[model samples]
Target: MSAQFELPRDGVTRIMAAPPRLNLRRAASYQNDKGPLSSTSSRFNFNHLVFSPPPSPGLPPPLVTRPRKLSNAPRPSRVFRFVFWVASLVAFLYVASLFARRFVGHVPSVMSWAIESQDEYEMVGQDELPDFPTPIAVTDVHGRSKWTVSIPPTHTFPLSVQEYADMCAQCHEVAVHVRELHGESTSKQQARASYYYRDPYFVDVGEAESHGLLPGFSKTSKATGRSLAKPLIGESWDYMVEKPACKTSLTFVLESADGGLGTTLMLLWMAYGLAQKEGRAFFIDDTRWAYGRYTEMFQPPPPADCVPPPRHEMLPCPHGARHLVVSAGTARDTFGPAFTAQFEDVRQDSIERERPLFNLARVGYEALFRINKDDRPYVMERIEELKLKTTHGTNGDAANSTIIGVHVRHGDVHPVEYQYNGAYIPLTIYKERIQQAAVAQHNRAMPESVEPAPAPLVVLASDDPRVFESEEFSGVIRAQERIKLAGKVPVVQPVLDKSVMHPFKEEAVGWEGGFFRVMFWNLGRPSIASKQTQISLAPEATKLRAFIGRAYVMDLAVLGATSDVMVCTISAMGCRLLAVMMGWEKAMVKEQWVNIDGDYSWVAL
Candidate 1:
């Protein structure tokens, strides 16, 4: 622990600068000069004395020695020649320096001296000026002075968008920051600013004269057919920055003493409104803020003392010009026991039976709805007038009665399927109603001598089975006659063809359903309610529609399933009825039919 350590040796040595040596002065003789007089000596004299006396201070210095002229060696004296050469070189250097001072005056030393001694240098025009400065005279296009008022030190007159954005930040931030502060409403605010409502005429100056709406803008084109407004009126400023339209109409107006005061306030208010959300300030008079001078054009003066026409004048009625009657029955007779098998379950209570029986009634009503909504009675007056035979008839015993017609469109409208089960089915119901009405009229015309029953019903099938399926349609005809005969009547049916199809189209086009066409028709009161008219004696042809809970029930059966049970359960039915009533469909229905076993054995009314 106490051991001494030895220091290692280094080969490097420190060097020191030597002091300057002083040279000894020696005397010089002109006769015994060596090589040349020492350059330190001023001169050497050879007139007398062994060593030349130090040159007298008062005596003039020897003239720079002249070059020697010798026969053997005509050479100049080394000292004399050196002195002469030195004098010549010094004079040449002095002349060179004078030339350099004149030519290279921009050298740093000269430049610094020039700056320090500025008074010594003369300045030409503009050379001593500070910088470019604001102009003295300034005015805007309106010939209003822009320089009248001092511009505030902090306020820039025409700020760039970026600068304006920063300036706007004092009131509210721009873009995302604005969005975050204001939330969803930010976009709406931005849209308002971006779509600031300049006159639409101004936006589309080319169409201004043609529009004839703005008299002022139109006047701009009065001098020539071409509108001068197009060159002057432009698009909005907001549209210019973020998204630009074809052109910008923004203008800088010079404020006049009288006019600009109101305009200035309005502009400030507009700018303020653009920034804030909830806050409000003074009302702006936009007229004062108009950007340009405009005169009203040749506007046609309005007609004097105009009077309006009366409301609710009578419109022409198409069908017979008569008040048409449409009626539907719930049950004309419950019928005799011969038709008792047609009844639903007897064990069910009246309330339960009422539902199904009423549904059955609705099926007939549904058919009637189709005819009324779609067919025009006037167009079908001839068809309604044509009578068919009724009852088991011999030649003379035959009774003639008018044919009531019914028609339906099932998916005939193509892409907009007028389906039989939905709103579209009302057209069918109306058709059926007209058919019933015609039958009722015939029965009312029945002679009192013979017992009267409901008028006979006739349905004109528009499409030939050939139009859809020739073979199937042929079979449909055979089946349809049975339907006609079952009710104890012969149908005066039209042959299905283009002409028959025209009636269907006419009926649809002529009848427009609304409160007027579908109004309730008054029939004498039933004896059950009031004995004035016996329900029993009432025209068997009179018709009625069934409604429950204020809504028409759509088809009771689902597609491919024939029995007339509701397609949806009672609860779902309620929901669907609501949906349909809310205009999901024009109409809906609940079908009624004889459910034999599980099969729906049904006949269209």
Candidate 2:
């Protein structure tokens, strides 16, 4: 018997055989065991685990994602957002309006346009435009409507003492009001009153005529006793009425070696007086030597009624008329014999020793020099333009600031070698003068109890650039510093570039081969490379003239717009002209000074 085998399942016994023959039932059972398991819950096992197959080499890796958290913050309200936006818009508009107002304030209106429309808007004549307050309807003593006319500022000449005092009160409140409050105790007020009396404005027209304070006036003449209201010779009304006929012509030549703008103006006024007295058409011949450089810088309005002679015409007089050639520097007796003879006759019998002829010329000069209405607009425009051009920076604050004009004239004035060299003024002298002037001006502008005025900016004008190159320029700066140390605000001097000197070129040539060339060539030696006086050949005179002429005009315009005192060389014609234009006559220094002649005393015209 073969070895017996026991089965533990149910106590079954089986004999081990070499191999049980292959049965179909056994093969079927083996195949069933390899089949897939059921996915239903009934066949699932909780503890059983299964493994997944590896991924293919070419595939992408699996993606992992993070969970997000939800926010609970509250959003802004609609009303709050709307209110915020409205506030921002209002702020933007307010800022914009401020800028608009500033722009409107800065831009000057076109005065020409306003003047042109005067006829349409109002039925007033140019002469009827009120300078001072006047009634709408003017009447005589009888209460009947007389002609309604306005007296212009220019017509204030020959004003009475009372009228002058009234005008002074209007123009200068501090001078008049302060003195009146103090019972006129200040010496300054007395000095100013004396000056006012001497001014042409305060002269009594009737008294002046009776005293024979005019040319061609005989003391015994019946006309001298006429009423003051009636028009008189040398007056504007008389000048207008007695102008020469169109056919008659007269020429006046002004000849002088050292006469500048002031002297030339005085001479021109004398010529005008003679022309009016003789009833002859007048013209000025300045071709030989003239202030052409200054005159040409501005395009002054043409004379209202007269056609002046052409600039290029050397002979302005009519073909047959005799020319009256007068040397401005000649003795009074020989200056104009025909006119002088009448004064001599009056002087012989006059009780007052004062020279009436001199007073007549002075009065005429003031009248002729009054700026005309037509020229006013041009002057305003030029002043604005120059104020912009001369000042630095884009904001243009300097243009509006108070300007203290300092004009130092040097070069070719007189005594080039020694005693009176124009450029010989010491820096210390200029500093002291400027400081004193500034202080006086400050005191005059404000009341005693009030704070001082804002410090004025100093504007330098000089014929010789060397005047500025001197230590005096820096000395002026130090003077400003001294003002600050004295508890006042400090001022700064403008930094002017050298290029401002040249703005035009001279082209015209005359008997003198161009006024600039002849005048400057005698000033100093010429330099070849610089093309300026003392720096070039005589042919370059045109360039030199252009440079100096433009600079001179620029200086005048700058000085004209200044608001405060002007410290200047007393003998300089430029200083006098500036004082007249800017109405700063009282501020000028009255120190003892000399001219080209070694005469210790000299007075500007």
Candidate 3:
């Protein structure tokens, strides 16, 4: 037996005899009133409750309660899920398609679309095109299309100075007639006649005199007799002073043999110098021979007529007045003392050289042909008009901005008779030279400031279109990194079209690759005396010539507007003419030469 003791009711201590060990199988078989511990088990108990025991000291505390289970919400059906996934996929595809359509497909820009639409509409016209006829296909000597030339419809020549004035008069007359017949206002008449031609501003003689632009007169004529003259406003006749005694007229006769445009311009300059020195009105007569023919090609201004009564129909030498007949060979000596008192002789026969005239050591070239301040406005206006009429593409920015002009002579120069025969300059040389010039010009034009300098624009005038195909030329257009220009440089050139009339193979025999062939088409047979023969061209030749001339003039204007740095080929007379027009110093103009090996180098002209 085992001893047993009982304590008071509040606390108990008991000893009892040890019972037999309970059967392990029977203990395991015991079950609680509640079923197995599961999510459905209740926390409340019917009998006395038992608490959990403490965890062992070395182990983590045991959990007091089982974890709450997540709610069994019903899952979506398979069909619904499939439909939802398909709809999501379709939405994603639709969005991707829209994005691709907006940005990835063959979508054209608004400008491009508009241009294309315009071109299509133009092609849909039924009647034959005006000004430009069907291109006359011609085969070259090699029977290849590459060298083939196309002749376009003929056009009329440019209006001469007299012809232009007459046309203006006719327009005014027509407008007046229309107004009288229809009782229209003067403004309406002007509007109706506006398309015919532009009337240049009349230069005021008084203003010219105030600016010291009028020529001076040192001597008087010997004739002292009365003469009959027409009334100022009407056709009535009146008696006037006979053969006014004043050395007020100077006439310059350009030689027929001087065919080059540059030579002609030099002669004009010489005549201008003499007139300015002697204070005499000047006249240029280029209407007789070779130079005359060339002169006729352009529509130059008429002789200045500012004299009072007894006005001669054409500019004429004063009666009984000593004449100064100067040739190209004696120009230097003749003009040397022209501005000084040493040139007192009334009659001086001076000759000039075949080259451009330069001033003596004292007078600078700029001072020699310096344009009067009054003439600047006219020149600028003329240039603006020419640019608007001639430039094919958008050259608005270039016309107003800093531009470096490059004149390349490669067409007629290929002929042995040409001054620069066998001289072919590679495109790289031009590119390098242009780059250097651009850099220099930029540096000179840039102000000492923190802002980056504006890159200069390049205007390329060349006889051959192949120059554009060169890596160097294209690189400039694309503004490649390899070019050493301080800033990106852009290049502009005239676009030549096939519809325009061009010279035939026979007409361009010597100058097969020249701009003349593209600009003028010879329609008649070659004359015996090539120099004396008049160039008979297709009706369209005149229009083309005028267009090309205007374009060339605009190019020069652009160059002149630059920062006084010009890079040009030595053989390119056009470039020299532009330099002279711009009043550029000899040091400012750079001449490029081509060696026998087709290499290019530069020197001051």
List the pairs of residues colliding in candidate 2.
527-534, 527-535, 527-536
By summed lDDT, which 10 consecutive residues of candidate 2 come out lowest? 478-487
Clashes of 3: 17
Question: What TM-score against the true fold does each predicted structure earn?
Answer: 0.16, 0.37, 0.37
Off-target runs (Cα >4 Å) in candidate 1 are 1-403, 410-605
Greater TM-score among 1 and 3 belongs to: 3
Clash number for every model?
35, 3, 17
Ranking by lDDT: 2, 3, 1
Error of 1 at 396 (Å): 9.0
- Runs of candidate 2 with Cα error greater than 4 angstroms are 1-250, 254-262, 273-280, 290-323, 327-402, 414-423, 450-454, 474-519, 522-540, 543-547, 582-605
Cα-based lDDT for every prediction? 0.25, 0.39, 0.38
Highest lDDT scorer: 2
What would the per-residue lDDT of candidate 2 be over residues 410-529, giving only the tens digit for each residue?
544433335556444554666666656655555654448365444445566665434544675742211111011011233564576887785544333222211232444443333233
Whichever of 2 and 3 has more lDDT, that candidate is 2
